[model samples]
Target: MTRDKHDFKKVVPFAFLIFTIAEFIPVLAYFFPSSLPRNVLTYSQKRKLIEKRDSIRIQIHTHINNSAKTNKGSDNAPLISQRDFINSTNARLVSKKYASSFDLSKTADFKTAKLMCKFFGLSSIGTFSMLKSRLAAHATFLRTDDSLLFKDLDSTVAGLSTVQLIEACDSRGIPTTNFSFPHLKNSLVGWVQFSNSFSTIEPGFYLWSRIFLLSKIPTTN
Candidate 1:
């Protein structure tokens, strides 16, 4: 009975901590409404999900182009030529199906996808579909200077997912942090965001980093 009481004492605070964090989410979400995805439809709703995802992509790109043109002359500004933008967008869509399949959970599937990506790179496929998608997403992103743009873009291009992102970054010689895309995506999705994202953060520090971020309550003075 003494041990049981002691265990209860230990568990109660942790349980309460989880409860507190859960309660805090809505309040945080309310203040940062734009940070949240517009909706959380189950993956089983394939048609509705595909429609929503497509609509969001169109909206984001349109916003990026409009914002880019307004800032055209700056040296560091988004100056992607109209022709490049059109070509990139088309190329990105071509690989969208493949990009969506680059999940790491199924090791065989991931290896096959990686080979296919490499094949596209070695072959005469125009724009190097996967890289082209990354560039298109990156360019659309360059046009906007929103503080939240990076995170929003992360969610938008999540179809590229995490393992692919790592490979993409490595192939292009981009610097990366220990942070994982799967960590961020799963936390954002409140469960998981497919195989790659889930596996990327599984039982790791990245997962804890997400929990820490979510646990904080924004203060107003």
Candidate 2:
């Protein structure tokens, strides 16, 4: 009876801690959006996470800084420039069925194929002749900017799914410590979407860094 009672005693504290973190904290956060509880990590763990975060943010900065090397306009550069890609008529003009059925190799499928060329660092996506080159360059990302971040990321932030956003924010060293999930997610998502509209790379980097800073509410204060 004593052993069972002792085990029960041991379990109760752990259960309470879990309840505090998993339930109580979120409840507190929902009510107090700006203020967040902080620093659930040990001092050493916090230091380590901070180091990792700083290292990755530096890498992101370096990647953004060095992105200007790949000049966009070559003689054979795609008629569909990267900035104009979303609105490009190349997609509307060329249909997959048409391209397959007819020898439309001469057509610049800018929104689709040609944009792929631009993204992959190819100087030309102007012809079907470069299909092999495009495929070969497929592994590369020429822009070296935040747009590449969005390539695999879903822009739909309304799903209320916080897992991937948390991972992304955490990896970016956004101090996943104490903010309400919804506000943090909203800040990051809204910043990304707003930054995405700019024709240049700087805005996206700037906006993302802003969110990262905002997510850095002190764990204690």
Candidate 3:
């Protein structure tokens, strides 16, 4: 009876080990959605998204006009406005973790924030909205090599004046090439979409990365 009891105890542990391994397999698979092919949206779906984007642009124009009218009364407005514009642009280009730390909203004027919000299609719910849209449309992960495409496009828009950027955005349709503002705009959307796809795959990994970034600071003795 003692020997039989020992054998049963050993067998129970081995069974538990196998069960644990079996449970982990699906979890491991779910963490690498980036390995999957791109999911294409239907034409009607794409049209709806485009229309939504245009409406946001119109809102941005109205905000910009309102901000300009308000700031016109201040004497130091132009210099402050230009500085705020550049700072806001840089803030959006950087990671949200860092952008929030910089307090870009506090530093940027309403006009500048509206302009960036227009350019980047941003709101408080921006990232969450992108994730939800991707999930709803069954969008696929972006290609790893897509970063190279945006680098040149970003450089082209980076060289433009603030006025030029606003004008370009007003006149431009969807970007087809790296030479135009639309190209840069499309790249920004690509970035957010790709980031959302990645965050969805391994939310813990994304949370850790953001937390790790936030934890770093200068320590003084």
Number of the top-ranking candidate, with lDDT as the measure: 2
Clashing pairs in 2: 38-219
Off by more than 4 A, model 3 = 1-40, 73-102, 105-147, 150-221
Q: What is the C-alpha local distance difference test score of each model? A: 0.32, 0.38, 0.34
Question: What tens digits encode model 3's per-residue C-alpha lDDT throughout 92-185?
Answer: 3333434443333233344443344333332323454343332222212222222333345456556755334432332222222223445545
Q: Give the lowest summed-lDDT range of ten residues in model 2.
A: 1-10
Better of 1 and 2 by TM-score: 2
TM per prediction: 0.21, 0.28, 0.28
Q: Write the per-residue lDDT of candidate 2 for residues 108-166, one digit (tens) a residue.
A: 44443443333222334345556534433322121232355444434444543555455
Q: What clash pairs does model 3 have? A: none
Error of 2 at 67 (Å): 26
- The Cα error of candidate 1 at residue 79, in Å, is 1.8
Give the candidates in order of lDDT, highest first.
2, 3, 1
Q: Distance (Å) between predicted and true CA of 53, model 3?
A: 1.7
Where does candidate 1 have its weakest 10-residue lDDT segment?
Answer: 212-221
Q: Of the pair 2 and 3, which is ahead by lDDT?
A: 2
> Considering TM-score, where higher is better, how would the candidates rank from best to worst?
3, 2, 1
